[model samples]
Target: MTARVGVVTFPGTLDDRDTQRAVRTAGLEAVPLWHRDKDLKQVDAVILPGGFSYGDYLRAGAISRFSPVMETVIAQAKAGMPVLGICNGFQVLTETHLLPGAMLRNNHLHFICRDQKLRVENAETAWTRSYEQGQEINIPLKNIDGRYVADERVLDELEAEGRVVFRYEELNPNGSLRDIAGISNAEGNVVGLMPHPEHAVEPLIGTGRTDGLGFFTSILKRLVSA
Candidate 1:
């Protein structure tokens, strides 16, 4: 059967369509999931795309974390379903406690939008299997509160367990602690990142680079093999 990947759209989400397009580009079915809906439509995977969900009020993803759809997503994610959260979506993952750490305002207190270079620190995660370890790729990053922070112990644990999946290369855009751009759960089924991979999936858009396509392709490969 063709793998189906669901893209969740919350009240203020803006990248659900782009995420669906990326799924299709990766030869998978794109399933639309509404924040108010509890059903997942049996999608093989789920993506919480970037955007100012709930207007990013009271912290970026705090409100969206309580959405009905997320109720089921949280359950499924813990049960080993593959979950990928991008940008604002990453904030939601952190809010929901599906991923470690928290996102704070950009250290410079500025909204940054740029193509960021990242190194694949842990390619064994469910969302990064397509990239080789240590490989470098450029993807667009845009957000006001994108800095990732955690206690020293948690940061050390993430690194020690090889859960820090992606790290900023050369230049850290948002001043995220340890230059962490992305991370995965211990089970490797849940991954979150601050960059907008969906925006970089196509070669004709957003810096004209296709480096982000690997993220979509990586999930498809995982679902297909399962």
Candidate 2:
């Protein structure tokens, strides 16, 4: 059977459509999931795309973590379902405590947007299996609160466990701790990252680089093989 992936759309989410396109491009059926709905529609995996949920009012993803859809995402993710969160979605995962650490305002105190280079630190995660360990690739990044921070103990634990899945290659655009750009859960079923892989999936669309296609394709292979 063909794998079906769900792209969630929260109230202010802006990348759901682009994420769906990336899903379909990876040869998987793209399912639309709503923030107010509690059902997952039996999708093999789920993706929480980027945007300012709830206008980034109280905090990025702070309010969105209470959305109905997230309840299900949290439960299923604990049950071993694959979940990938990008940008603001990454903020949600942190707010939900599914992933360790939290995002802070850019060290420069300004929203930054650009093509970013990242080194694949852990290629075995559900969303990064298609990449090679230590592979350097460029993905488009855009965000205001993109700096990732955690306590010293938590950061050390993540590093020791090999959960730091992606790291900034050459530049630390947001001044994230340890230059960490992405991380995965210990089980490798959940991943959160500040960069927008969906934005870099199409060669003709952005900077003519499809380096981010691995995120979608990696999950496809994971679900199909299972």
Q: What is candidate 2's CA lDDT for residue 49?
A: 95
Q: CA lDDT of 40 in candidate 2?
A: 99
**lDDT by residue for model 1 (117-203), tens:** 999998898899999999999999999998999999999999999999999998888889999999999999999999988988888
Which 10 residues in a row give candidate 1 its minimum summed lDDT? Answer: 198-207
lDDT, candidate 2, 44-158, per-residue tens: 8999999998999899999999999999999999999999999999999999999999999999998888989999999999999999999999989999999999999999999
Per-model TM-score on C-alpha atoms: 0.99, 0.99
Error of 2 at 165 (Å): 0.4
Candidate 2 residue runs with Cα over 4 Å from true position: none
lDDT of 2 at 78: 99
